[model samples]
Target: MKKYNLYCIVLFLFIGAQAKAQYLQDYTGRPYYLKTNDGVQGNPLLTETWYTATVDFANGKTANAILNYNLRGDELLFKNPKDSAVLAFVEPVKSFSIKGIRLEESDQADITFASGFPAVDDQTNKTFYQVVGDGKIKLLRYYKKKVLESTEFSSQIVSRTLVTSNSYYLFANNQMVKIKPSQKTVLAAMNDKADKMQEYLKANKVDFKSDVALAKLFGYYNSL
Candidate 1:
């Protein structure tokens, strides 16, 4: 309930900013100016509601604000503290943490994201990846969002919608490898400790389908 209230407050701020038109931006930052009724069909953000977050900039500065991740543009945006204006970082963030439950089973744990990994498969060091499991061996989830166009039959109007497909990876020993949330792929990535991984798998009933489960598996593997 408290989280929902926070969302409402943040929404009100942004909504008020939109009314000014003078405050909302497009082109200066990666975000396209957000419109409550842009004729666009879907949300561009990971969450339409803003979150209370602490953003760590590349310059080593930090700030607290109501923010959201623009999945379509792959940008982190925050609302101005003063005018409630929507803003984006001149520099991409090194990392950030939002206060809320990202995964249902996380028990209201704060979710964090970080960048700086080597580029692979069209992703750069600046591309933020959700910090699922960390330590020597880390698990990350890259949410790839794309814009899709659709038109209803007998309607000349076309609609653009934002959709995301997520991919997972394991980073260790200065290397990052793409992975699927399956025991086979996970074991293949961590082949060095297959036997130990098998032992852990047997001891804990891990449903690879669950992000939390995969994270727990990687956490244990990293502990080894």
Candidate 2:
């Protein structure tokens, strides 16, 4: 009986490992290329023509993106922006930055990943991926370790945009709940602060030292 119980335990462990085996950091998949102009935006490009897709692995998630070339000879560029030392892969990749991969009943799979993710010094938590419908993924952006922006898609279709809190949420209700700036305004502020943060980091020679410095700058920027 003990031997049988041990066998069952091994089987369970094997099954658990297989279930997690779907995740891979770098991916390779069949390419589906579509034509596009030089600098067209994402949605318009999608409307214009179908783009190739490859698996991605980053931010502890698995996701897919439009591939620029065929899978066999194309290269993958992994840029974290925050960590230059993270190493970028320039190989013929079918997928880069893949985290979680799941298949639907129809055989279509959803891949999830995150990029340009900014977080605090400890890196305890940050925005991550959540699988949506078949072949759909979304970003679960977090602020103060709380989910803030949810960028979701369904079967490659835009589902919805949900903002969990206004800028007032940042102030802990101690300050007035002034009307939060528009999306453009907030983005501009963030961009400006990011630039300043970069400058500050380089000036202080502390770019990769810790993320808390950048986070403080972002907080100040949001207050403006």
Candidate 3:
């Protein structure tokens, strides 16, 4: 009986390890090629340098990779940990988290992303939003990049530059409430304790425009 129990335990451990297999071959896209235009001044991705990431594929597969977010493409791009070739999993990703993604220099926390939020503006349920803070109430941030082109009529030479922007949403009780990072919008979204947030901000001086500041604000709200 003891020998049978030991065999069962070993089988269970083996099954657990298989469940977490990388399954990198299932990635559904071709080798990624950067769509670089001549005279472009900035990168099209959130960070030019890749960071370690864990991706959850739509088919219940997961993998660890060296990855970056392509803001212009609105997709997550990753390369096999064993190779330098970049790739994209064209099949939708269920969710993902990248270690030390550096959304802002002041914010060092590992960033997590999720989809399936209600469609707002151009963003659909599949659009990935950065989750800020913790608890049942979450602040979601959607980062966007736009390209501006300029030309000199004499030379007719064109140059493009990428600019990034952030949009915030408050998710609570099965809803996504769009908001600015101001005291009013924040307090209104989390109106249960608007007074406390106001008082806290008066003493704390949270910078409304900063991503880290907005995250800290939601963190404080969740604590309440």
lDDT by residue (tens digit), candidate 3, 51-115: 87787878787777677788877877887555677887776787889876666533746788888
Residues forming the 10-long window of minimal summed lDDT in candidate 1: 22-31
lDDT of 2 by residue, 4-37 (tens): 9999999999988865564333433323333234
> Total clashing residue pairs per candidate?
0, 21, 0
State which candidate has the highest TM-score.
3
- Stretches of candidate 3 off by over 4 Å are 1-30, 37-41, 57-62, 104-109, 153-155
TM agreement with the true structure for every prediction: 0.75, 0.18, 0.77
Each prediction's RMSD over C-alphas, in Å, is 11.1, 18.2, 3.7
In terms of lDDT, which candidate is stronger, 2 or 3? 3
Q: Flag the better candidate by TM-score, 1 or 3.
A: 3
Quantify all predictions' global Cα lDDT against the true fold. 0.76, 0.32, 0.77
The residue-by-residue lDDT of candidate 1 on 135-214, one tens digit each, is 88888888866767988899998888766777888898888899776878888877888999999988999987776677
